[model samples]
Target chain A: AQSVSQHNHHVILSEAASLELGCNYSYGGTVNLFWYVQYPGQHLQLLLKYFSGDPLVKGIKGFEAEFIKSKFSFNLRKPSVQWSDTAEYFCAVNAYDYKLSFGAGTTVTVRA
Target chain B: DVKVTQSSRYLVKRTGEKVFLECVQDMDHENMFWYRQDPGLGLRLIYFSYDVKMKEKGDIPEGYSVSREKKERFSLILESASTNQTSMYLCASSSRTGPNSPLHFGNGTRLTVT
Candidate 1:
């Protein structure tokens, strides 16, 4: 079974600080990676996705993720985060199946 | 914009009572999914439907059932609600165009079983 592992359970950072949330998946085959964000009192929304081509994918809200096949990792990164970026971030992986397996999620709290 | 709407934002059900969590998608998506989100457990897939009236059991489908009579609607049913089943239920719909398509999520229905 394919499973996703997010290294950070909870992260706190000051405004304008660089951020990185580690994500690793267990699938050995071709996998599609995604970063989804759930803002306060809002539904979960897709930030970005990587299917093919570029391993480094840029997403909305100044977020980006690098997909490293050798490491089985798709780590989310932001050069500078804002207070508004506080939310629960989830890393999900789809291995060409109809279902997606998600990580335990990382709660990012950006302090201003 | 793609929207997936759950029937309820919060639900309270008694043990041994049958519970239904409804989901509707407006994008005419071919895939509808039911997931339970719990602390420390993330999102666990309960069931999914790829087409109308067609369903597939996901990772955690033991105590849950699903109905999909229409293309835009997928319903999750709990034959007998249990306290262990108390969690936020999220409904999502996606296109079956290989893997690039992301899942559009509903606001989620938080169910509490007593």
Candidate 2:
């Protein structure tokens, strides 16, 4: 089974700081990459996804991810983050099948 | 927007008791999934159903089973609950758009087995 790896376990930053979370996957075959976010007391929601065409995908809340096939990475980044963007971020990848493998999530704590 | 609802927010059960986690999706999605989420372990798929009465075991299907008798509802059953099985159970659904389609998740059910 394929696995995903998120290097950062926890991140803490002040408001207006730029945020970047690293994500890497194991499988080399055709894959779909995604980033999902879960706010406190809320369910997981899609942040962004990458299937084909463009390697740079823009998602909600001014979040974006770049899928670099050679590096086997799809990293999530934001120019400036708000306290509201504080949430648990997950990086997921699925191979030809419908089963998605998720990384150990990263908890982003933004201070006011 | 897609809405998925889990029947229970929290549950506690004994070791030898049978446990059921129910999930219902309002969207007419063809696929439904059951997953367990733990800190640092991420989300692990337990089971998924493609259509009515069709089920498939996922990466961690041990000690767990699922049923999909209807299109909207999917049920996960544990024959004898164990302490290790205690975790946040998540239910998600997606249309048959493709494998790339994002899954719509429901508020999870936190289960504890004593």
Candidate 3:
């Protein structure tokens, strides 16, 4: 079974601080990676996704993720985070299937 | 933009009662999914439908069933609601064209079983 692992369960930092969230998946075949964010009382939205080509994938709100296939990792990063970036982030992996397996999630609390 | 709509934002049901959660997508997406979200558990897939009247078991489909009679609508059914089933239910839809087509999520339905 394919499983995604998020290294941090919770993250806390101040506004403008650099942020990085580690994600690792157990799939050994062709895989797609994604990061989804859920704000308070809001629906889950796509943060970014990595399909093929460039390992560095960038998405809305200045969020970027690097797909390191050899490491089986797709780590999300931001040069600076704002208070609005505070939310629950989920790492998902789809491997040779239409369905995706998500990690346990990481709650990021950004202090204003 | 694709829009996924979940019928209810909140629902409360008693144990042993039948529960129905409806979801609809405006786009003609070929894939629809049902997921349950809990604190720290992220989202666990319960069921998914690729086409009309076609359903597939997800990672955790033990006590749930799904119906996709139409391309735009997908319903999740609980034969007998259990307390453990109390969680936020999220519906999502994605196109079948590319792997990069991200899933558009609904606002989610918070279901509480007593």
Better of 1 and 2 by lDDT: 2
Per lDDT, the best of the predicted structures is 2
Write one digit per residue (lDDT tens) for candidate 3, span A36-104. 999998999998888889999999999999999899999999999999999999999887767988999
Off by over 4 Å in 3: none
Displacement of the residue B95 alpha carbon in candidate 1, Å: 1.3
After superposition, which runs of candidate 1 have C-alpha atoms over 4 Å from their true positions?
none
How far off is residue A57 in model 1, in Å? 0.3
Writing each residue's lDDT as its tens digit, candidate 1 over A21-91 gives 99999989999999999999999999999999999999999999999999999999999999999999999
lDDT tens readout by residue for model 1, B9-105: 9999999999999999999999999999998889999999999999999999999999999999999999999999999999999998866689999
**DockQ for each numbered candidate:** 0.83, 0.85, 0.79
Lowest summed lDDT across 10 adjacent residues in model 3 chain A is found at A93-102
**Candidates' chain A TM-scores:** 0.98, 0.99, 0.98
All-Cα superposition RMSD per candidate: 0.7, 0.7, 0.8
TM-score of 2: 0.99
